[model samples]
Target: MSPEFATRYNRWRYNLYAPVYDRVVAAFFAPRRRRAIELLAPAPDERLLLLGAGTGLDLDYLSGCRQLTAIDVSDGMLARLRRRADRLGLAVDVRVMDGQRLDFPDACFDAVILHLILAVIPDPVACLREVERVLKPGGRAVVFDKFLPDGGHAGWARVAANWLTRLIATDINRQLGVIVGHTTLHIEHEESAGMGGFFRIALLRK
Candidate 1:
């Protein structure tokens, strides 16, 4: 889809789901996300950046970190994230920024997390490239998302999954690990969870 079309669709779906977004998403991905974060084990004082940080579901769990910036495109989602931050008494600077055009300096952050984001992004390659560009030398990034099966039934399955996801959000089935490898990134850790050949949490570096 065109960028203009994709942006409109994304904003529309997110606004439509804002009322029940937290309940619906948390019920499905919370457990897996917690496990992924544990596996990543982000260190203190690291300049961490969270992309597509919907409702701050992972913010509470990120208390051990020093400085953090959470960015998302949806205003409705960001509002909920603010509330979540208030409730937890945490100070996470929030912004409504495009993932494909990060408004930050190069090598400024220690870590960047594209949690559950790439799958739903309209332009996965552009998004990943931006992440790579902003990452500091030897900085790490963790990508936790679902994609098509590696080989078995991948061709058709990926297409179908992406088609359906477009009704709710824009998601592609390309494995983030492979995509990262194709870019200027190195994989550090990788894990898969869930059936239906979906979901993975991978740690990568640039």
Candidate 2:
């Protein structure tokens, strides 16, 4: 699929999944999400950006940072996020924005949070480039996502499944190292976050 088509499809899919997103993903990813946030350790008053902040599940872990901006392509997701933020009294600036084309100025954010987004987005390289552009010098990005291990091969089953999975949710064969290599961001720390080391937490520096 083309980039435009993939973006539109992702938006439509996420909108349809928004209502049950928490029930479906939150519990399973809760541990990794917490670990990612812990690694971020945002200071008070620091400006932060959350890419693909679906349903604002990470909001509770980010309460310390007062300046929070979250962007997602799904209107339904952002709407749910807004309600959650309000109920929790968190001052988050939520916007319907594409990750590959960030609307913020260069060097604007002190930190960035990217969880469960790389595999789901169509253009991971472009998204990471945008992240590199918006993050301030010495800023860190906390990323948590499933990626194929270095030098490991995807089985025939996974390769075939990706054909269907990409139509709805995530691609299981994304290479984290290859994607990160496309930008200037360097990994400062890395750790296995979920089962079988498929999901990982990587602290990247700009």
Candidate 3:
């Protein structure tokens, strides 16, 4: 909600990075993404909300889901999502909306997934509020991302890596648990791992 947050995010993400988005993010984290998504273990009938879905790479991971709503800040990214969805005969309700200001009714989704999206936003806490608002009572969201590693992290080395990567991709150093603390969701489970010890997946309840 800060001044120009949506404009800045969309302009950079779409105009500056759309052409290379897939290659860069994929080259860096495809294998890791696959592993994380598999761990999510979504059921077929679940009403899924995918935040910052970016081009629907996660679509391939949703084998059994019946309904899916894909949201991204970039219209270009949503375009890619639509084309891919059309090619695959999958129908995802694509919305060109910021995660922090999702325009949906309460209790709209059975589950939500924020995959490497929080850190890219100006205020990840705002995005979490939107997630908590739309999710049904007792529903939960699963997240997969790389944050500044804490215990097993390489300390200064990891910090350097974060800054360097930010020039290209979003940094992997956000404490999503802390951001979601104000919401009713309880952090049910947390896991961490990666090539550089920089991945975290948290399951949360509303």
Candidate 4:
């Protein structure tokens, strides 16, 4: 499929998945999400962007933040996120925007959070380039997602599994290093998050 078609399909898929998303994903990803935010270590007043923010699962962890903006292509997901922020009594600037093409000014944010986005977003290279463009010099971004191990080849079995994975939710064969390499972002730290290192959390600097 074309990138545009893939993006549209993702938007539709996530919107359809929005209602039960929290119940299905919240518990399993909570710890990794928390760890990713902790790695970011944002200041209270810093401007932070949560790219591909879905259902605001990360809002609870960011209650102390003053300037928080979240963008997602799925309005259904952002609607739930807004409600979540309201319950947390935090003011968040939430917009329905594409991750590959962020509608933000250059060097405007102190930190960017990419939780489970790389594997799901179409054209991960474009998404990372946008992240690099929006980050200030020396700014950091924390990425938490499933990636094929660095330097490990994706065998036929893994490649075949990715076909189904991509159709329903996310692509399992995406490589973090290869994606980040498309931009100037540098990986500062990386650690295994879960599923025998299938999921990873990494800190990237721009």
**The best candidate in terms of TM-score:** 4
| Weakest ten-residue segment in model 1 by summed lDDT | 148-157
**TM-score ranking from best candidate downward:** 4, 2, 1, 3
Tell me the tens digit of each residue's lDDT in model 4 across 64-177. 899999999999999999999999999999999999999899999999999999999989999999999999999999999999997889999999998998899899998899
* lDDT, residue 121, candidate 3: 69
| Better-scoring candidate (lDDT), 1 or 3 | 1
After TM-score superposition, the amount by which residue 151's alpha carbon in candidate 1 deviates from its true location, in angstroms, is: 5.1
Cα lDDT tens digits, model 1, 85-140, are 88987778899988878898888888887777887777888888888888889988
User: What is the total number of backbone clashes in candidate 2?
Assistant: 0
Q: 110 in model 1: Cα distance from truth in Å?
A: 0.9
Clashes of each: 0, 0, 2, 0
**lDDT accuracy of residue 38 in candidate 4:** 93
The models' CA-based lDDT, in order, is: 0.79, 0.92, 0.77, 0.94
Task: Give residue 32's error in model 2 in angstroms.
Answer: 1.3
Distance from true location, Cα of 56 in model 1, Å: 0.6
TM-score of 4: 0.99
The lDDT of model 4 is 0.94
Model 4 regions more than 4 Å off: none
- Enumerate residue pairs that collide in model 2: none
Q: For residues 1-206, could you state the per-residue lDDT of candidate 2 as single tens digits? A: 88889999999999999999999988888877887888889998999999999999999787777999999999999999999899889999999999999999999999999999998999999999999999999999998998999678999998999898777778889988899999999999999986789888999999
The superposed Cα distance between candidate 4 and the true structure at residue 205, in angstroms, equals 0.7
